[model samples]
Target chain A: MKGMSIIVKKVAQLISGLIFLYGIYIITHGHLTPGGGFAGGAIIAGAYILNILAFGSDAMNLKNKEQGSSLSESLAIFIVLMLAVFALFIGSKIFFANYLPKGQLGEIISAGAIPLYNIFIGIEVAAAIITIFLALVIFKEEVKK
Target chain B: MNSLIPLFVIVPLATSFLIMILGKFINGFQKTITPLVLLFLTVLSFYCLLNNHSNSYTYAIGGWEPIDNIPIAIYFVMDGFSLILLCIISLIGFLASVYSISYIAKFTSENNFYSLLCLMITGMSGVVLSGDLFNLFVFLEISVISSYALVAFGTEKEELEASFKYQVLGGIASFIILFAIGLIYWRTKTLNIADISALFHSHETSTFDLFIQILLISGFGLKAAMMPFHAWLPDAHSSAPSPISAMLSGVLIKAVGIYVIIRLFFTMFIVSEEISLLITTLGTISMVIGVLLAIGQWDIKRLLAYHSISQMGYVVLSIGIGLVLLARGVKPTVATLAIAGGLFHMVNHAVFKGLLFLNAGAIEHRINTRNLKEMGGLSKHMPVTSGTSFIASMAISGIPPFNGFFSKLIIIIAAVQAKFYLVAFLAVFVSVITLASFLKFQRYAFYNKSEHRSTSKIKEVPFPMLFSMIVMGILCLAFSLLAFPGIREQILGPAIDVLTNPNQYVQTIIGI
Candidate 1:
């Protein structure tokens, strides 16, 4: 599909970076705040989707990135699972045990393993949403072809 | 020992992700990885069964133990009942995965198939092991969603239509289950099964409680494909690939549907005579109607799908009889026998029906058609498939010396001893009709002469398919020995004990 008007593309370019940054902030601070991996990842995916809408699918190279997105999504999930499994191996011999040292309560990294889980989940969810979106786009293009 | 509970969910989930990620780059990663994961699960499940036969333990995730005697974390409850389900899931899952090694070669994106299969296994294991009601709901959704995708994996027009129907019906079942969980949490103020049972024991029943009971039965009934809610089975099971059909019919429905119903009704809710009768009536209708429908089917898979409903009927009917006896506080020994019979039939159906579906797949793989009318004289060319399928058919029909016969005999004897003459009669009648329909299946599919010249070129299926079928066929005979008292007490006794005594379940889990 073709790109939107130049004005729309320019505005999306300006805002997408901010959106992406905000999503990262939300993910990192998830343990201390309300928004966690799912919410932040969705926001980040929304940013990329917005860019695709304004810049067009070809310009964004979404078709090429689909495989990468899927791979990363799977990797993210694997990492989250490994974190839990590793805790079982190292800490209390229990699944999902918090083996990391607990920092001060108000700090961003205070909760042992929670922030790490959130970060992995964020990457996974974002990649998953992007994969789904790209798949739909590719399917539409195929039908047109 | 409690630590092992999470492995059931973790192993499958992690392996699924790994296969999806790594299989994308590696040519045959899914083929090797999927079977290994399932084999590991099968061995682990059997190990759990042997070690935990006399003990039941609960694992609290993240060490979120209860405060003030109320469990706050997601608990994984492991008992004889869940272990029985675990064995069935892993065993059938392994065979189905092995079968898929060759069968799925025709489908594109083999990695996606294996990944989805692993995810489905994770969901089923999670459902069977989770102690919290909402956790069960979550896992149920996971399983059902994966299954919807798997059912449509073939991408045929009919496959898509069947998957759409399955998703809609399954979605409604999930919603109803969620709504019931909400009502339950509202009433008892706890999500843990043991805690809820304890709360219900201390309080008097209200109208809302009965409403919740009905809701749960209908909700889980749809998943289990109880008589009224079974419309999706014929289409969905027949349209999916053969191994998938086996998984759906053999283990999936039992794990998500019948298993949940039995666990919730027997342990969570106080059983009453009226509810017990309701369940039995549902079972009887499904038994009779399911077989009647099967007798007229021309498609091989469709015929087997109908029988799934019929066989599930026997299980629910026997268990219903047991519940009725328990509710009325009569014939405790008879009640135990009835429930044991139900459980035994459940395992037997998993083996034989799984084999039957695999047999159908083998035939379809060779002949490239599902029509019974189009097939004939196949036993000559495919001795292994025909031989194994014949054993499965006889076992399912309750012929003597096979597993089905022993389980059915127990149900019948239990029914007679309890003076439920009507149930006993129907059980025997259904067995006869089952035998008749299967005879038709054999005559038309394998024994009858074919007019079509294509039968001459038909050959046996690949080694993986043949191997799975043989394993399931052996299980059909081996599981019959559960009737012998020495083995029965070890495998089936603990499961029967947990169900018969609900109070013990609460005390064991809650340590009260």
Candidate 2:
């Protein structure tokens, strides 16, 4: 139930917000950048994981609380599915049709639906990683007890 | 018509996520929604199958048109062969879902089980429908991964152990398959199955092609649980929940393993006599070995699981017979018969094996034991389960008037006519052994007098479970109609044609 030293805790809190912001940067510019959803999502998950390690298990509960990580994970993927299904409803009904207009190449929103997909997938991946991490933590705790 | 293909994968996938989200707020949402979605899929698949009987239909995901006669799109093909598999996936999935409604009540995480089941369906649909090799691999993992979780749903000692073993073997299979696909992509510079076949033909046969072929056979062989690579079947199938065992036995192996082998070998690769011979040899060995293993099992579900391996052998062997004959370019009619019988047996196995497992589940539900020695004289208490299981056992044993007999009959006739007298004899011999084993199962589980446990207090499983078993029971008899010439031609004919003439597939897909 205890956490690490004060130095680690102070450093983790300092960098966590910066890491979260960087993850957003990577996800938002996924159309023009190398990192996209999966990589960016991993980095964001790393931020949360760092905070959890520095703070204790009780600092944040990640599964099945009020709109917890598990629920958010499910909700995120459901929205992504709806977006894909949205493509079918709009056009001659293609399942993954990029129905929206393309702004321009190399822009933040160039690819019509790719950025949107990347953002949602990033959320899903991030939430999913934390959820799995928290589950292992709880299991380890229960085993110790 | 082709456009509807994506819905098969999409609807189940969406339903899976939808279940987890709404299951938190709504009571019984997972139970109600899962069966209805699968039912909708079953109707959709049959409708599409009848509408486009002869020709293959292709859909380009994202509507990406072919670039200068080269396919740049992620393609999905729905021909007669895949359509048959689609029907199997949805039909079995629906029945399993309905059965799970009652059966899964004991499990605390009911929502997780249903979600995983739907995801499994989505993956199988994508596997059969996809026209790209890499895409199929992705879908294969999706389904198998879901199965790994489902098998471990109980989280008990045996269940965890079985899932671990299944995962290790399954991981190796996926690695081998992905390596093969990587080779295909490297060699042909395309992932489209139709284009790969077309490109393969334009070039002379090389050792590289043979290497990839061997890799694919071994890789998918592991997935199919062929003779040599079948250690995972009994443990994984027996340890899992009954509905999952039914799905894994009935649909998962066929759609992900045998169906892919049939599709890739028939349509995607030029027929090689030696490879086909190897396949047939594997089939025969698995047939004898699987049944031999089954006869000694005390656990009813484990016994049924071993029988799955044996029955799959019939399918692989017959398909191999067709492949060898086609490569030899002689007696096309006989090869057609062999394949027709194979495909027919696959369908019959799905129905009857699924029913048998459900019966085993029902028995286990009433009495807390799967060991046949622990059970006795339950025929009076659970008439529906015992009666249906009798039909299932008789059908699987190839008795007359059941669908299994007809399919096995066709396979043996074709084998004999093709001058493979040994195959014909072994096949018949195996059927007799299967009969003995099932009879033993019936005797001990239902008719035998047991001194150990009193059976007076045991009640039948609830309605939902019985309903699924009864429907599958009727299907065991009803599918015998498929053995008739008129109906056989209508149902099995197109599937046979697809395998016989591979060029039609490439032509249809590539617009040659």
Top model by DockQ, which number? Answer: 1
Q: Give per-model TM-scores.
A: 0.99, 0.99
* Best of the candidates, lDDT: 1
Q: Model 1: per-residue lDDT, tens digit, B391-411? A: 999999999789999999999
Q: Tell how far residue A130 is off in model 1, in angstroms.
A: 0.8
DockQ of each: 0.87, 0.83
Pairs clashing within candidate 2: none
Two-chain DockQ for model 1: 0.87
Which segments of candidate 2 are over 4 A away from where they belong? A62-67
DockQ of 2: 0.83
